[model samples]
Target chain A: MNRKLISDQDLVNLYVSGQESALEELVGRHKSKIYTSIYLLVKDSYLAEDIFQDTFIKVINTLKAGKYNEEGKFLPWVLRIAHNLVIDHFRKEKRTPIVTNTDGFDIFEVLGFVEESIEDKMLREQGHNELRRLIQLLPEEQKEVLIMRHYGDLSFKEIADLTNVSINTALGRMRYALNNLRKMMNQKEYSYRQAM
Target chain B: MVQTFTQNDIIKALYHELPASEMVHLEEQLENDTEIQNNFEDLNVLKLKLDSLVLEPSMSVISSILDYSRSYKK
Candidate 1:
């Protein structure tokens, strides 16, 4: 999946040349990742959906108005815009809504059912639920790093630059995140074994 | 220094983010240290566990974003 085939720079050129499909392609390529990032943070399907739209609308206007420079990095730039908007949404609402875990909606659970081995699939699903629960318990810094690295597919260096931290610091947060999750899982397993 | 490594160190090594010298040293230790190797395996399992938890956005969200973007046509 060479999703980068249509480079951001090329997309910008196409948009500037009045190629509307170019804009559509750019949005199509990145909509999922962008929406996921927003959704993770805001935890509201409707609001996250709104911000996702607004992010691209802002992108379109910026590009059309000769404001978007071809800086060779599009996703992060757009993400930053989306991030800021989400922050604004929280500010206007004056209260951050609690993120409810919708039933039968987790992508991993759906993927788990597709696995051939029922026992292995069950283990994977259990581990995933435990991990998700553990992640919510993580400190803000660690949670952000895990989300960006795993979900957003950003490199540690990119994440460091985005979050204004040293690469080692970013790496360290991810380290802590995994370590904490492992400990949590172990503790959970011990309890389950004792019960059994 | 007896070169004590923590769970975090194991994760850094797993992600290939450790400094080259530290990575080399860790690799050498893993070759000879069963405990460290076990920790590495545990970290791998932990990472897979974490990776599996990502939920896909709803289909309505996807369609809404596309529709929202299209509404800006001048």
Candidate 2:
């Protein structure tokens, strides 16, 4: 079967019908974005991995139980589950996102879809770590909105609904996120220029 | 109208989050406002930097998920 041509909805249908490889194909298709979304919020590689597993577990159970009603919104649905799980985790722990107060958290090793070897991919990814590091500098609200919009591909309205904020509030968080990133970039560029 | 237009408006316009009416209004303002244009350009640059990143889950975690999914049918 050409899994390449299968839509997510089609894959879901297959999984619900007892074709397990379809679910694997579906997970392989989305793991990067979905896992990244979870990691960004939790900021712990171990915890993120656990949550990632749990997200898929919940996905499987939901499908098996015939509760998966999202016809074309599978990614967002899974993402929402992951997002809610992260929120629930923090709520139970009575702690906020670790990056919100921490100075530096280790950037977990990333295995991207590029065809390069692991060493080459790591070397290449190191160049872009600064952006991720600066993104970690954003306030929690701003970072949440930015990640949901950028990585999850959720629109501002969807983000507002998911976060239970007004549309303007979601938009405002993104605005502030970009504004802060610009400020950080300017400062970094200034320091580099001064050193030059 | 241009005088009252703030950074949030420019960000909204840049991200395509602005409504049609506000978008039309902002487009008129952006036509002549160099500062607003500059800010929008900077935000676009930041967005580009962010696009370079792709955070993948750990291989072990993916394996765990696969294993869990396989065992889940019982």
Q: Pick the candidate with the highest lDDT.
A: 2
Q: Which residue window of length 10 is worst by lDDT in model 2 chain A?
A: A100-109
Local lDDT at B31 for model 1? 84
Candidate 1: tens digits of C-alpha lDDT, residues A1-196: 3546878788778877877667767876776677667766776566676787788778878887789864987887887788779779989989864645553334322333463687877776666555555677777788788777766767788888888999879888988887787787788889989999
- Which pairs of residues clash in candidate 1, taking residues 3 or more apart in a chain or in different chains? none
Please give, for residues B11-71, the per-residue lDDT of candidate 2 as tens digits: 6676677788888877777778888777777778777667666666766777777787778
| Docking band of candidate 2 | acceptable
User: Model 1 chain A, poorest ten-residue lDDT window?
Assistant: A103-112
Query: lDDT by residue for model 2 over A33-146, one digit each (tens)?
Result: 887788778877778788888998899889988999999999999999999999899999998865532322354544444588889776666655667778888999999999
TM-score of chain A of each: 0.76, 0.86
TM-score: which candidate is best?
A: 2
- The models' CA-based lDDT, in order, is 0.71, 0.80
DockQ of 1: 0.38
Give the distance in Å from residue A72's predicted Cα in candidate 1 to where it truly belongs: 2.8
After superposition, the stretches of candidate 1 with alpha carbons farther than 4 Å from their true spots are A1-4, A96-99, A102-129, B1-13, B16-26, B67-74
Lowest-lDDT window of 10 residues in candidate 1 chain B?
B65-74
